[model samples]
Target: MVADGIVSAYPVDPEDGPPVGISKDDALTLKALMSPVKGALGYSLEDARQLYLKERIGVGEDPRRHAARNRLAKLFVRAEAGGLPASTLLVDLTRQQARDVRDHMLTYEKPGGGKVAPASVKRDLTIMKAMIGHAIREFDLIKAAHNPFEALEVGISSGGEEDIAARELKETLPDAVIAAMRGNLQGELNLIWGLGSRHARLSH
Candidate 1:
């Protein structure tokens, strides 16, 4: 039954990883990491990784995978129709998102299993905002409007939120480098470019 739903309505091959097209497993991990800022930030969980694996690879499947899969599938179809190749930067962004999600899952709870720094939600938010910025730069794409990632000013700004924001991310390389990916994509790309504009709120 579940497999049928995934195959029919989803319309995505189990191997087609994410909006940018990575391994399905990588997409799933990123989905988990972006869970906290889902609706308010429109962050994607790529939950389909586990579900796809469950249906096709024999691992445990998660139920929430459908939404993310649907979202990416739609993006992929649109991008293909529009003639834009999937950006390598976007693929890298998804990969990083997956890693952060794994880190949060392992570190979120204490030894007994509880929230560590309940007050630091903002800090996490800050990290997320920076990550998004890096995504844009790494992909070397500009946005159509203002960057939502810059507006994500939601993290704990204790002493120097300004300073942290100022800190540079090594992953966000120079513009020419990211722009260099033109025509190298194998899948979909965001309709608009840039970090400040493409951000979506997290509902979960």
Candidate 2:
């Protein structure tokens, strides 16, 4: 959903969950880390990171939140490497700039030089959208018209064909094996089989 073709229907609120310890000193530090002004592109990006930390870290911490923060931090570094100055205004980020970031994520390597999964890249892009949306709708830091991320759609190039192939291979159990399992575990096997079939259908 959207509002006036500007704000998002779902706005992020830091206070929605348990309060976080965003001390005055820390806030000042984050602000200083940003470009002296509030609406600079890097400043808003930093604010988005702060929002994610406040909301996801307030009540408790988990692997998922940790992963999300790390992904965003990595993307920020990539943006800097791509020549976007810390003082770039939020309104100045172009559609091409956003696309460049997506492209970079597509080939991003893991710490051990392993390929990053498409699903992981997709998740990071989704987080980027949410961060930009929150900046626009909740913080009123950037006007929706000036939000470059608003026009972009994140998609894996191969339509997740690799994932489908992996799932198919996993489910191709032999009839004899399936029969033995069903015979040994009648009711449990029935439930499991039904769920597996339902999941396969939904995946299509």
Best prediction by TM-score: 2
Stretch of 10 with least lDDT, candidate 1: 39-48
Model 2 C-alpha lDDT per residue in residues 110-137, reported as the tens digit of each score = 7887667766766666766776666556
lDDT of 1 by residue, 51-71 (tens): 333443342334445554453
Task: Please provide TM-scores, in order, for all candidate models, with all chains considered together.
Answer: 0.22, 0.48
Q: Give the residue spans of candidate 2 off by over 4 A.
A: 1-43, 55-68, 83-86, 112-114, 141-146, 150-204
Candidate 1 lands at a TM-score of 0.22
Taking the candidates one at a time, how many backbone clashes does each contain?
29, 0
Q: Which candidate gets the maximum lDDT versus the true structure?
A: 2
Clashing pairs in 2: none
